[model samples]
Target chain A: MQKIFSYSNTMILLLLVLCAAVFYLTGEMSSGAELFPRITAFGLAFFGIVELILSLSRKDSMEKPIKKENNQHLVRKSVLYMLVFFLLVIFFFLCFPLIGFEVSAIGFMLIAMVLLGGRKTLRLWPVAILIPLLLVLVFRGGLDVRLPTLFF
Target chain B: MELFGAVLNLLKPLTFLAMSVGVGWGIICGALPGLGATIGIALLIPFTFGMSPLVALPMLAGVYAGAIYGGGITAVLLGVPGTSADAATVYDGYPLAQKGLANKGLTTSVSASAFGGMFSALILLFLAPPLAKASLAFGPPEYFLVAIFGLTIIAALSTSSIIKGIMAGFLGLLLGTIGIDPIVGDMRFTFGAVYLYDGFPLVPLILGLFAFPRCMVLIEDLVRKGSSQISLNLDDGGGPKLTWRETWQMKRTYFRSAFLGTLIGILPGAGANIACFVGYASAKRASKKPELFGTGIPEGVAASEAANNGTCNGSLVPLLTLSIPGSPTAAVILGALMIHGLVPGADLFTKHAEVTYTFIVSAFFCNIIMLVMGWYGSKWFGKIVQVPTYILAPAMLLVSLVGAFTVRQYTFDIGVTIGIGTAAYFLSRAGFPMASILLGAILGPMAEAGFRRAMLIGQNDLTIFLTRPLSLALVILTLASVFAGWRMQKKSKPMKDALSGKKETQ
Candidate 1:
C-alpha cells in the first residue's frame, strides 16, 4: 500500500509538471501568459522534489514485508461496489433528462440500494417510491428549482 | 458605546427572531447524525432569499455559530459526535457521562462553547476592521505569499508521511488550474467539455471529497463489523449541573483553547476539526491530569468545546475581511450570500457596515442560544442515536445528491461529485490528507493568480514576490514553517522506527 502510494504521488506530480510545461509553451511565450504557468510549474516541481526526497529517506523504514491474514476480507467487494456505483451514476446522468428526474432518481436509488442490500422487499418498495417523490417535491415545489420533468 | 449601539441594532425584533429561528434549526440539524452545519446552512439559505441580505446574513451566521456547539450534545451522551468538529468532545465527554456525571459534562461543554464563541466574535468585531484596512494594501504578490503560507501549514499538520500531504496539496492546485483562465479568457484543460468551463463546482466537489468518502468509510466499517448493534442511553438529569464555581476553575483552559481555535480559524483553509484536534492535544499537554483526558475529565470537554466553538466564529474573520472562506461551512455561507446577491469584499464593510456589525452581534447571540439550547435540549437530542444507519445513510445520500444538483442543474455535477468522492476514498485509504488537498484546491487559484500578476508587474522577475515587505515576510514565514516541519519529521523518525521494531519483535 505504501509503495503504491509513493508511486502514485510521483506519477501525479510528473503529470502535473508535464501539463504545466504544455501550458508554459502555449502561453504568450513572454511575460504575458507564459509567466504564470512557469511559476506554477516550478512550485509543483519543487514540491515534487521535496516529496521524492522524503519518500526515498523513508523507503527503508516503510518497506515491511506484507502479512496476509485471510484474503477473504470485503476489500474486493468494496472495490466492486464502488465500480458498480460509478457506472450506475454515469448511466443515471445520461438517462435522467430523457426519462425525467423523478423516474431516474427513484430507479437509480432503488437499484443501487437493493444491490447494496435492501433485500427486505416490503421496505424497499416504499423507499423506492417515497424517496424520489419527496426529493422532487421539495426541490421543485419548495425551492422553485426546476428538474428535468417528464410531466408538464 | 459604538459597540453597544451596534449590539442594540442587532437586538432589533426581526433580527432577534431570525437569530433564534436560525440557531434553533441549526441545533436540531447538528444533533442529528450525518447532518451537519454545512447541510443545515445550505438548506436554510434559499429560505433567506426573501429577506434583505443584512437579515439573511446574520441569520446564517447565527446558524453557523449554533451548529458547531450543538454537536457536543451527542458527543457527550451518545459517544457519537454528529460532526467532525465534535469528535474531540467525545474524548472526555463520553467518559464523564459513563461515570454518571453526564449533567456536568453537558454543562462544561455548553459553557465552554459559549465562552469560546463569544471570545472569537469579540475578536472578529474588533480585529476585522484593521485587517480589512490592511488588506486594502495587498496586491497579487502578497496574496501569492499568503497562499503559500496557508499551504505550508498543511505540511506541519500532515501525519506521519509529509510526502503524501504535499502530494495532495499539489494535486489540489493542479485541480484548481483546470478550466478557463481567469485573466486571459483562454480555456486551459476543459477539452471542449462545457461542464469543465465553470471549473469543478465547489459545493459538489467539496461535499464529495469530504462527506461522501467519510460515509463510504463508515459503510466499509459496518460491513466489516457485521451489523454491529449500538446501544445508547441519554445522560441522567439527576445531578446538580456544573456551577459558575467549576466554570471559573477552568477559565484558563477555556481561554487558551478559545484563543488557539480562533487563531486557527482565522487562517485561510484551517477548519473547525483541525482547531478542535489541536486544542485537545494542547490541553492534554498543558494539563496536570493528562492521563485522565479520554476518561471524562472536565478539562478535556472544556478544551474541545471551546476550540470548536471558537473556530466557528473565527472563520468569519477572513470571510468579512478578505472575502475568503476559512472553512467549508464558511464556504457554504459564502454561497448563501452569493445566492442573495451579496458579494463580499472591501466595500461591504463600508456599504453594509450595519449588516456586517449586526451579523457579528448575532454571532454573539448565537453562542448564547447554543448554550441555552444545549442545556434544555440535550435529553431530547440524545434520542437521535436510537436511529439506525440503514435508514440514515440513504436519506443523507439523497440530501447529498440534491445539494450537488442544486449547484448547477446538470447531471454532470453529480458525476463529478461521485468521481471526486471515490478518488478521495482511495487517497485516504492510501494515507493522504484530504483536508490539505481540499485546502489546496480552495486556495490554489488565489496563489496562482497572485504569482502570475506579480511576475508580470515585475517584468518576469521572480524577485518581486520576495522584494516587497509584506510579501517577503510571508515568504520567509512559509519557508520557516516548512523547515520546522521537516525538522519535526526527522526528530520523530527514530521513535517511529523503534515502535515498528518493537511490533515486529512482538
Candidate 2:
C-alpha cells in the first residue's frame, strides 16, 4: 500500500485537488477573465490524473531505496540540519521588522553557522559579523537601495 | 555599421568594467556548488536597477557566458558538477584529474568553451536581427500559438515523464493566472491581498525557485558529509598544454558540437545542460576510438565544454528576437530586460539597436575574457569548491532574501520568496522540473493576452488560428515538438536507468 502511493503520485494527487479548487474558484470571475484559468486548470487536472495513473500502474512505482543501513544516522543528521536551517530562516524573517536587517542578519548568520557545525572554527565569528556589514555597505551605501537598518 | 558602433560602446571604461566584473563573479558563482548561472544572474538583477541598459544588459550577458564555462573548472577538479550543464564534462574531466592531467583538462575546457561561445555569439549577431524582423509580421494569433509551442516544447523535453513535465508547466500557467486578467482587468485570483494584485514579483519568485532550494541542499550536504574541508591534491603546476596540433585535431569536434549547441539554444525551452550531453554523446559516436572517449581524454572535455558554452549566446537568440527565453538563465535575463524598460522583438533591433548590439558584442569579449581568466584562474577557482558549506549556504540565503526585498522594497516580497522557495524545493524533490514552471509563468501572460486579443479580432471564431499560415505552421510545429519529446524520452529511458543504477552503486 505504501508502495502504491509514491511521493510523485501523492504530489500529482495534491496538484489535481488544487486544480479542482482553482477551477471552482473561477466561478466568481467574469467569463472573459476565467477562460484561460479554467483551461489551464483543466489541462493541469488532466495531465495530473494521467501521471497518477501511470505511476500507480508501474511495477517499480516505489523508488528504490538508495540509503544503506549504516547511513541512517547520517541521513537523520542531514534532515535535522535542514530543519534547523529552515527554522533559522523563518526566525530571521520574523525578526527582520522587529530588530532591523543588520542586527537580525548578523544574528541569523552567527547562529546558523554554529548550528551547521561551524562552531569549531575561528573564521566563523568574523565571517558572520563581517558579511552582514559588507552587505549593508554594498546594498545601502553602494547601490543606494534602502535596507531595513535601525540606525543610519 | 551598428555592429561597429556596438563594439565601440562595449569598449567604454564603465561598460567594460561591468562586463569584467560580471564574468569574474559569474565564474566564482558557477564554480561553487549550489550556486549556478540562474542564481548568479538572479542575485545580480537587483544591482542592475541603477545602471543604464548598456552596462546592465552586457554585464548580464557576460555572466551568462562566463558561468557556463566556469562550471567546467569544478567538473574537472571535483567529480560533482557545479552546474547541471557541466555534468557531461564530469565523465572525462574527473578521470583526467584523477590521472594527474587536471591542467590539460582545464586548458582544453577554457579553449573549447571560448571557441564555442564566440562562434555562437557570431551566429546571434547575424541571425537575431533577421528573426526579429520576421517576427514583426506575427499577429496576436501567431503569438498565441508561439507561446503554446514554447510551453509544449518545454513541458515535453524538460523531464523524463512527459505527463509530469506538462503537468508542471500547467501548474506554472495556473500560478501565472493568479493576478488580474490582461484583457478584462478583473482580478481572477488575488483573493484580497494587495501584493497579489500585481501578481508574483518576478525577482523574488526567481530567487525563491532557483536560489533558496540550492542553499538548503548545500546545508544538507554539509550535515551528511560531516566535513567542511575537501581534501585537495590538485596539480596546479603547468602540466601539459594542448598544442596547436592537438587543438587542430579536435577542430571538427568543436565545430560540430558548437553548431549543435547553437541550434538547440535557438529553440525555446532547451538549454546548455541538454546541449552538453547531446554534444558529448555525438562526439562519442563519431570518435574513431569511441572506447577511449571517457578515459581522461581532452577531446571529451572539449566536446562537452564547447557545447555548453556555445549555448550561452545561442539561447539569447530567441530571447532577443522573439521575447521567448530559450533557457532558465535566459528567462532571468528577460526579467532584467523588462526591468530596464527594454522590450524584445523588432524594437530591440531598431530603436534600441545600440543597446542590443552592445549586448551581443559583449558576448564576444566575454568569451575572450573568460578564456584569459579561466586559463590563469582555474587553480584558484578549483579551491572555491572547498569553501565551508555552512558559511556558503547561510550567506547565499541571506543575500538572496535581502535581494528579494530590494526588488520592490516590499517586506511582503521576502515572505513570497521564502514560501515559493520552500514549495519549489519539495516539488523538485518529487521529480518536478523547475524550468517548466518558469517557462509557463513567463509565457502565461503572453499566451493569455494573445489568446484574448485574437478572439476579439476574430469575433470568437475558433478557426482563426488555422486561417493564418504562420499560426497553422506554429500549431503543427508544437505538435511535432511534443512528438519528438515523447520519442526522445522513450529512447533515453535505458540511458537514464543505467545512469541512476551507476549512481546507486557508487
Model number with the top lDDT: 2
Which residue window of length 10 is worst by lDDT in model 2 chain B?
Answer: B497-506
Question: Any residue pairs clashing in model 2, and if so which?
Answer: none
Winner by DockQ: 2
lDDT of 2 by residue, B191-270 (tens): 79898897778778878877888788777767776664575447456367677898999999999999988888887756
lDDT of 1 by residue, A1-152 (tens): 55434544545455456656666555644424444455555666776677556555664645332334364567667657656766776777777778888888777778777766667888877887888888777678756667788887
Query: For candidate 1, lDDT tens digit of each residue in B325-423?
Result: 677577666556655655455655676677767777778878887788777766666666555455555555556666677756777777777788887
Which CAPRI category fits model 1?
Answer: acceptable
Error of 1 at B163 (Å): 4.2
lDDT of 2: 0.83
Estimate TM-scores for all models: 0.81, 0.93
What interface RMSD, in Å and to 1 decimal, does model 1 have? Answer: 3.5
- Model 2 bad stretches (over 4 Å): A62-76, B233-238, B281-292, B501-506
| Candidate 1 clashes between residue pairs 3 or more apart in a chain or in different chains | none
